[model samples]
Target: MDMEYLKQFSLDGKVALVTGAAYGIGFAIAKAYAKAGAKIAFNCRGEKHMEEALAAYKAEGIEAKGYYCDVTKEDEVQKMVADIEKELGTIDILVNNAGIIKRIPMLEMSAEDFRQVVDIDLNAPFIVSKAVIPGMLKKGHGKIINICSMMSELGRETVSAYAAAKGGLKMLTRNICSEYGNANIQCNGIGPGYIATPQTAPLRTPGHPFNEFILAKTPANRWGTTEDLEGPAIFLASDASNFVNGHILYVDGGILAYIGKQP
Candidate 1:
């Protein structure tokens, strides 16, 4: 047991920026990162959720702040990154967790729906990542965790576009690591399973067959919680994952390995 080799899990004095931090997995990750001793810049849709997250962090006795960053907007995203670096100091890590998905069937899904999902989920990561890279490069070290999805590797009938976007995100992450690994920057992704969140609550409703199928497929025999991802998030954000670059770490509940369909 080498003592000095074990300090990579600590994130003291680092700064992190997490998008979609108002609630759900993003919020949980932000709070956990703060608890691990990182100054946080949590972003949401509006000022209210940002303030609420900030206040909660204050209660936890950790340094946290709020910012308005619409990941879809290039200019706004750029300004937010700059503002975060200037106000909160350099952003040592970034979590691209802001995304949305529409559940309509492909034939019935509108063009706008597909575009919106791709824009926010996939395109925004590209925009925001670009905005933050220069800062990371200048500082000579940074970590990026793009919130991917199980859909990145698996496909569903009604969610073709969502799957496509996430798949693209997977390659994008690898490409980023390939191009920037030499610069001391690490880029990876977190593909969460069926987490119980406000956004995912609809997936687990009364008379919903999806829920039953999901549980049966997962070896854990239950849905995951947002809290389940906090440990992995902290590890990725900290120095623990310094050698872990261009990887898609699946936090799924073994559903990915299940070969049998639900009976």
Candidate 2:
């Protein structure tokens, strides 16, 4: 293998902003970017999470900068971006990893609740992207990776709002690519399927119906881990994916392609 070919995957000197990176999926991606030598900046909406996040990064020997900003609010997002630019230079990679999910049934869910989910999941990406695109354009190249969900393509019970928001996010990713590709901006998405996070540990216990169901539906017969998403996230945020845009790379265990196994 040519050593020069591997350089395309390096993010050295690039500045990356990963929203909602206090923990879980966002944290994993940010850690991966730091490993690839990018300067890391992330946000948390609350003081407690912000403090904890800074500690977590430090534990990893990463000197990550954390900001307290609500992504759904444009003004707060704008300020965060400006601060990041001042501290870390213009952002060359943006991972729109901040989002929320409301698993309420359609009829039972209130419009306000639905709107809140959409605002964070869909609109925050738009707001944050708008804030960073100008900097990216000035830099003459950039990468924006939206953390979409499997719901972007498939729907399940009790997730009406999440599905809608993620579906809209999918289109938003494509639209960003369409609008900014000419300016050397590559906007893409990562759609994770049934990631096994601490929040889902209860559901993943042995003999759990939901766990069994997920395993049956997934061709890999296992849940995805945050580690599983790291490489793909790195690729999308690196020069390796300069030509890859407007695409949702599902880091699923083939759940989207398989029907359930026979009983």
Candidate 3:
């Protein structure tokens, strides 16, 4: 690789916008991008939490600002992206990390619940990508990383809606890659294993069957930490992955590979 190839992995002077950046995986992604020298336009639903994330980033001496956007709302998302570009310049790196995962029985899930999952999980990436693509095309380069889930490929009993949405996200990532690859836009998906997010705290209790089952299924024998995701996030968002398009990179601690057969 040439010197330029090495610099491609450096995101200095790049502008990144990460949604759901208040906490969890999204927060981790934003930090990773910032650490890679990209300025951040972090998105959160409200002001206070947004302030917290921005403050934290500033403490790292990274250029970062927060925007408020309810991703499920079309107008809000469009306006938010527009404002980010206006204020932060061209969005060179866009991480579609904001997603919601719910555990509800298939039969018990309402039409509204299913729609909500689709809106947040599958549709939000499309919305943000749609808003960011033109600028990227104009610049002739951009990177988009969608936070898909292991459920994108596998189905579980209570998470049918989440599974469907994540599955759709994986396909959506590839579809966008196909449509925009010639435009120098790289789109990819990241599938994380069962992570120890606040949303999954209930399962973190001792002897929680949910936690134990996930651990047993995963070859790494541990719950996924947000810290486990930083490096992949940086690589995908940086020029390091310039030729990597439509790839579904699983950071699953070997869960996807094991297939859960008791040996």
RMSD each, Å:
2.1, 0.9, 2.2
* Weakest lDDT window of 10 consecutive positions for candidate 2: 97-106
What's each prediction's TM-score?
0.92, 0.98, 0.92
Candidate 2 local accuracy as lDDT?
A: 0.94
- Give the per-residue lDDT digits (tens) of candidate 2, residues 154-211: 8889899889999999999999999999999999999998999999999999899999
Candidate 3 lDDT over 1-263, as tens digits, reads: 58776776688888998888877888788888777788888778877887788777778676778888888788998898889888989899888888776778988889898899889998888998899998999999999999999989998888988899999999999999999999989999899887888878998887988788888898998888998999888888887788999999999999888868575
| Pairs of residues clashing in candidate 1 | none
Top lDDT hit? 2
Writing each residue's lDDT as its tens digit, candidate 1 over 1-263 gives: 98677678777788899888777788789889877778888777777777777777777676777777788999999888989988988889999998888888999999999999999989999998999999899999999999999999999888978998999999999999999999999999999988887756897985688888888788898889988999989888888888999998899899788885635
Q: lDDT of all predictions, in order shown? A: 0.87, 0.94, 0.87
Error of 1 at 247 (Å): 0.6
- Candidate 1 residue-wise lDDT at 239: 82
What residue pairs are clashing in model 3? none
Predictions ranked by lDDT, top down? 2, 1, 3
